[model samples]
Target: MNIELHPRLAADCHRLGQVPEGLVLLQRNASLPWFLLVPATPREQLHELDPELRHAVVERWNRLAAWVARRFDCTRVNVAAIGNVVPQLHLHVVGRRHDDPLWPGVPWGQTLPARAYSEATLASFQTELASALDLTPAPR
Candidate 1:
């Protein structure tokens, strides 16, 4: 299988976005510490991925959840698979907080879009997370 990420994700990849190591993308969305993980397979749908790869992705999610919980002091981690628009296989790992502006409710459709991170902040967070994750660049 090839690794064909969405155009936005591809742009993120090129920009060297701070997503978790081995888990491609890890884009920081404007909402609830949202991040997207692009598995290194040319798979558009989740079911198309082999079981092992699927398991690996899940593992990555778990690892990332831990990372988010500790880093953000989030009360919970929301991991979802909703391929409404981007059909490419990806996982959404969100850092949640009870006091978060939209706590006790779904973050989606509950608030305005995210604000882009400042250059310095984005760079620092990216580097910090990448180091903490101890990521290994996946093979193509």
Candidate 2:
């Protein structure tokens, strides 16, 4: 079944690529290194997915976490699925360093405005992430 992404999420994030688990990989348009794994299912939370799909999500999470740590030299990997604004089944994978703006604090609910990556920088990052994660472009 094909699922649709929410308009807000679509607008706020870039379609980095897609994972084998039928989930789309999105890069948040913020200064910090952030990504989102969104299952192409019409569910609001992880529990709503079938057992097999749930297992896939966990596997993807593990793979993504490891990749983020290695690629970014991040001190921490923050992954969560709290859909306060966009109530869709998606996971946020953030690469955080000790000296980051929100260091020792959560990135969520940070009052600071989003510092978007430059167009060229964003393109370069998308290339790097796609290569590292072995991600395919999401279907239009």
In candidate 1, residue 114 scores what lDDT? 61
Q: Write the per-residue lDDT of candidate 1 for residues 10-122, one digit (tens) a residue.
A: 65432334233235454544456766667766676677788987777777777777877887899988887777767667777778888777778876445545666556755
After superposition, the stretches of candidate 1 with alpha carbons farther than 4 Å from their true spots are 1-4, 8-23, 26-31, 136-140
Assess the local accuracy of residue 74 in candidate 2 as a C-alpha lDDT between 0 and 100. Answer: 94
Worst 10 residues of 1 by lDDT: 13-22
- Per candidate, the number of residue pairs that clash is 2, 0
> Candidate 2: which stretches are off by over 4 Å?
1-3, 138-140
User: Where's the lowest-lDDT run of ten residues in candidate 2?
Assistant: 21-30
Q: Which residue pairs collide, candidate 2? A: none
lDDT of 2 by residue, 1-140 (tens): 35567887777777766776655555554667788888878778898899998998878877778887887899999999999988987898889999788888998877645677676765665567577666775433
For model 2, give the RMSD to the true fold: 2.5
